[model samples]
Target chain A: MAVKAGGFKRRSGASSDIPSSSMADIAFLLLIFFMVTTVFRREKKREIDWVSAEATRKIDEKRKNILHLWIDNVGQVWINDQAIADEDIARVVRPIYAQNREIVIAVRGDRDVPYSKINTITKQLQAAGAVRVTFATRLEQRLQRPRR
Target chain B: MPILSRKQRVSDEIPTASMADIAFLLLVFFLTTTVFNEEKGLPIVLPEEKEEQEVSAKNILFLIVQPDGSVTVRRGESEQEQIVAYRQVEGILRQELAANENLIAAIKTDPSAAYRHMINVLDEVKKAGAERISLQMVGE
Candidate 1:
């Protein structure tokens, strides 16, 4: 007697045809996304020439409120174009500064101004109760250029 | 009467939702909308201290230093002039302290002025009973 034979076999699993290399592309995309989204803090600034020193240090940005004061090359002292006497500085500043709790006063002394003048002002500010005082300087400006 | 039997079959299917496109869109939106902060400066050399001290709110004062060796105090629209003298800064500072115990003073010195002028201002500020001092570098 001859037995009946099955003509075909049926497959029971799903096909795995998707490419694996696409994972790298997704990873790269995610990396680019994060890099684009990150935020950076801004640098605080003022325009002035400061005396240079060998050492430099970073100051905390949040703790201080800056006030700008200028001395021109021709020996003129100006607080925003208004000339003030050396003695009355405290009275002028007390009211405006009273609103802020912690303030940092920055001095931009002109190289041409007499050293004695700057010293006298610094002393006055200190006596008036300024907790922290800083002198502004430029590094490149401080470098002595040879006279031709 | 005859009853018929029903057979049930289960099928597996793949999902085709794309999240990468949405993520990319969001990233682009944030990149375009975000604002960057600008640098506000001239570099300043601050005085060093071993311990950090807190400045009282009521005691803070402002002093603007001009390119010339003059100091001024602001009192609203009007200004009081030339309060800083080499010898009398201490006395002036003491009087200010008498009015308010928590006196902190700020010095805004011009870039063109001499270093000695700043020192003098600092000396006067110290004499004036300012426990805390701050220096201003840029002019407004």
Candidate 2:
């Protein structure tokens, strides 16, 4: 009887490992969720080359109030990644102007492009009757060197 | 019977000792593949064409841009137009701007000029705290 009691105690005390085989599956599922939701925002930043400016105010307006136009380093004009000719800028801008009278046409050009391309774009915007057109510039140090 | 039970239990466990390693490998793969947001630009409005009144050259500052990225600033109150470097425009315009708050800097950029230089001049003009700016494209 004593021996049987001891055997029963030892049997009850035996340790068993917790199951963790599903850990890889859980982690893989989470990784897939993140991968699908990840957005690089590639349209604006790729090859932009924004020129740095000083004492420039922020773009205070809401995203809905502005139309973003980007010019690549190679002089290719794009609106939301759609290629549009310089001459057709007005056609694209006109209707948006009609819908929202307070719309601002913001021109973002690459630092390496020529002024001629910018001129053509702005002129087209004007012809499209866009009253508010602005150039986009990156920020730089505001304080100047002290006077001698 | 004992041997068969032992073999069955070992096969049922699924060999999960390497599970943590596989999870870490997948996590690392995702971490390396993430994309982050970048910086945006500061917006400024161009002057209205309908409000284009004929102001004499003496009333405005002219920043002439050449194809080689050189800048020439013409002051509002003075008739003299001097070829200035990009760095000098900021201090020069700032002093002149302090004296007169209503000064306007007109950018007469040659179409052949590099676009980066025009933006540089615009930056300096804004740096000087001038409120009114006009851009006119010159030379096709």
Candidate 3:
């Protein structure tokens, strides 16, 4: 009878200590959840030299509200990973602008792209009534000489 | 010899007491290493279609960007144009803006000019704190 009582007390005592064995399982579950829900940029990156500017600012708009318009040196315009014709810009942007009135167009043009190509895009954006625009550029810091 | 035998009698099962610690360490490592690529640019608002306003030429300060990356400054109501490098634009624009608070900085880029030239002039114009800015093609 004493042996039976001792066994019961040992079992109870073992359970009284929190089950830390499952801690790893819970941590793994959270890690898997984050890995599954993480959203990465889906668009294919285009190869083009980015222009740098001293006046570049971090766009304060939300991710969804901003649209990227990439103009390559060959004068190809890409939007949402689709190659778009210059003439059809207004047609493409109009419905999008209608759906979201707060959309901002970010022009990501290659440094060597002709200004004429950019002008055409701006005109198309105007016709579509998507007026708010941003010229995406790298931030340039002026190099100062070290004091002697 | 008996102690050696006793030492071998210890638990043969693998210890997992620090499994949680290892997992948590990995989690913290990934969390600290994840870098978000934030969007950045020079923001400008283009006028809506048919919303163009007619302002007097006296309030306009034209900065013409040629195909060779030369910037020419043409003030309002003055035929005299000043040729300057892109670096000198900020100072000239600052002086003009200070002289007239209502002055507008207009950027005219030639069709053949590289986009960087226009951006450089635009950067200078923005650096000078010009509120009213217009971007136009040279032929237009």
Candidate 4:
């Protein structure tokens, strides 16, 4: 008996063998997304004005307690409402400062106040045991137009 | 012949290779979404040093110089008044030193305040046993 050898045998498995490539692409995309989404926290320091060319590192805001001081254009040293003598600054600050060890004193001076007064006040705060100090200034307004 | 055909059929099967590509794509996607931080600014003037010196932590304090040239202690919303008198400050600071041996005082002055006024305040703080002194400018 001659076997039929000319007939074709149909393949039993499915025609498509390759898996979907979309899953890999999705994974890679997710990885890139995570990397781009991550944010680094920068150390926060109290803002102060420095006249020197060198810059200091930033400090954390949570650790700092700020003391606000205002200097008038006339060079008068007023602490809140009461006028204080030049010599009495440390004395007044010492007791108040002792209560809180972590304090950042912030100084806001008028543009016209003499530098000498500013120096004097800084010296006194140092004597009173203030560890941190910050300066406050308004950003220079951009010149709009030349005066007509 | 039959065994050879079976082997041929097995060899013709395709392998799945998309997982690696998916992983790489996910990694790239996450990397593109990250954000960075910006630095904040504070207007401060550091004191100049004639010689290289280390400031002791025990002698530093803080002073605030307002636009009006007035001085005060930074105590939260409620500020305390501390004027620029040498004798008065010296005495009070001395008491503070007695209580705490390690005290470093820092002074924050306003740029607008008279330079003379700042110097005077520094003189007083120094007189009170504050060895380590630093100056900072006020930022609005």
Ranked by TM-score from best down, the candidates are 3, 2, 1, 4
Give a tens-digit lDDT track for model 4, residues A1-148: 7645644565557857565656666666667667665654433332333221111224345432555565665555655455678778788778767987766665655644566676678778767766356544332222573422
lDDT of 2 by residue, B1-140 (tens): 36555543356556677877787787788788775433345445665657677876555777787777778777756777688788788788777677766667777898878777888888777767777887888763
Cα lDDT of model 2 by residue, A1-148, tens digit: 4676656556455459665677777887877887787765535555788777765566666566777789988899998778998888889888888999888777788888888898888878877778676677766674676532
For each candidate, what's the DockQ? 0.09, 0.35, 0.49, 0.15
A14-120: candidate 3 lDDT, tens digit per residue: 45678899999988877777677666787888988999998889999888888899998798999899999999999999998999999999999999999999999
lDDT of each: 0.55, 0.75, 0.90, 0.54
TM-score of each predicted structure versus truth:
0.35, 0.67, 0.82, 0.33
- The predicted structure with the larger lDDT, 1 or 3, is 3
| Clashing residue pairs, backbone N/CA/C < 3 A, model 3 | none
Shift of residue B130 alpha carbon in model 1, Å: 22
lDDT of 1 by residue, B1-140 (tens): 43455555555653223445555566667677666432232333344333336565455565666656677654222444555543455566677778876666767667666665665566566445466566656443
lDDT of 1: 0.55
In model 3, the Cα lDDT at residue B24 comes to 86
Alpha carbon deviation, residue A114, candidate 2 (Å): 0.7
Number of the predicted model whose TM-score against the real structure is largest: 3
Worst 10 residues of 3 chain B by lDDT: B1-10
Stretches off by above 4 angstroms in model 2 are A1-45, A141-148, B1-39, B76-79
Q: Which candidate, 2 or 3, has the higher TM-score?
A: 3
TM-score of chain B of each: 0.49, 0.69, 0.84, 0.46
Model 1 DockQ reads: 0.09
Q: Which CAPRI category fits model 4?
A: incorrect
Candidate 1, A20-42: lDDT as tens digits: 44644675587586776665533
Candidate numbers sorted by DockQ from highest down: 3, 2, 4, 1
